[model samples]
Target: MELTAVHEHVWVIRGAVNMGLVRTQGDGLVAVDTGLDKQAGKTLEKAAKEIGLPLRAIVNTHAHADHFGGNAYLLSRTPVTVYAPEGEAAVIRRPMFEPEYLWQGASPLPQLQNKFLLAQASPVHVEYTPGVPFEVDGTTFLPVALPGHAAAQCGILVHDVCFAADAYFDPPVVDKHGVPYMVDYLATCRSADSLRSVQAAWFVPGHGEPARRPDAVIDYLKQRHEQAFQTVLAACRHPRSLDELLADVCRARNLAPANPGAYVLLRTPIAAYVTAAVGQGRMEIIMDGGKLQFLTIEK
Candidate 1:
């Protein structure tokens, strides 16, 4: 992991995750988000120590395993406290909640139990309120409510730099996965609009490079999400089951899921789009032939 100084007091690890480090009045560093697992946490700790920055605390943008998975490892070795948005904090405290919900609240399959989806439990020492300036020692972080990816995610703003944790992916990382991984279609779109107005000098996303002006990147994300939603909506005209709609959208996009764990999760995006359509009166849920199906409403 490489730490590049973005601002005088703000530095970011530019790799898979744009993990942030904000120097405080005491010169200690506050980690924006931990990485994938223990090894990532170890590397991060080593990186900070190499630069003479002692770890003080962590602010997890969301409860997704990849973002906060290293929290447990860091807490095990360091005295750093963790802060997360309330609903997300609840999930991080009980890491299994993600996989359980993904698997319809039943026992999650072994494939869904990997570090990618399941991380060691992490304690949330603080529940930050969005739109409020979160204080850590003498440092103040403006935590913006960036829901959609997770129920309660926040984008931390410090030193004129916005640590937009997956609020919108950068160009190369946009739609990296076949299906858009979102829980709520409308919320995700609104968040795209919200991300563009954060007024930060630099926007560092969880994936891809930081952008000074991210209009193009954010627009691309919106376009892709619109296409995904429209694809699902179009397929619903024929009254298809959720799985069938997923297949139709994937086939139209010429994408293949990497594994069963991934395929199962794709249902979320599909359901999100369908739910939006239902809310907008463009689609209706029905039961036909003992199967749940979605049908486009005739306007």
Candidate 2:
């Protein structure tokens, strides 16, 4: 585990995915997101020991396994108050857990599979409000709602550095692939644009190194998003179907089809981009025998 101090009270813990620890003015600490599997508990424990503080609160940015899988374990160790996005909180409290909806065909992390399968979805103790201030251990964190990544995803701003959850990707994912999967592609763009306006000393992404300028990441996302849209436009010239579009996207990107789940997740943004273009009169979608086909607008 590695720790990168972004501000006087905030630190980013890097492992399989980045987790955050913030020192409150009073006592205790607030953890944003959790690492993958049981390792997250270990990582948080190590971080707390190193920093010499007790955990006071835990905030889950979303309901992804890697982000929230460690909740059961971490809560078992510390008496912490937990908060999650309202949409995500519903999933966490559902009576019958369904992994297929969230992660189809993907194997659960060894340490967390049982808890996720058997645990009851409980009501959210605390709900998130965009740009609303919440206090933890005497430190106030502004929870800014960032949708598109997930319906109720949020980002945290402590003074200047924004802990931008999974709204943006890093490393092998975005750095290498140059694209990200967002349920609402256009909304994702708007969210990134809003984040870019925040003049912060640093921004800590969910997956990459702490960034000093949000503009760089926003610019990268915009460029890749447009490129992907163009690729979709070009591929749809022949009235290609969704599956066909997926195939072409994978082919053009050199992605393996063996991982259809991953491919679908990655292609979701392309699907959204195409859908958006069609809605805005920039492209046309024709229904042929129950299948939709796309065509770019001329002009």
User: What is the C-alpha local distance difference test score of each model?
Assistant: 0.86, 0.73
TM-score of each: 0.97, 0.87
What tens digits encode model 2's per-residue C-alpha lDDT throughout 16-130? 5789998888868888887566667678878988999888888888766567666667777877888887677776555233244434445533432344333434345787777
Model 2 residue 268 distance off true place after TM-score fit, in angstroms: 1.8
**Which RMSD does model 2 reach against the true structure?**
3.7
- Candidate 1 per-residue lDDT, tens place, 173-274, comes to 665675657788788878878977778899898988888977888888889889888888888889899889888988999878888678877888788899
TM-score of model 1 vs. true structure: 0.97
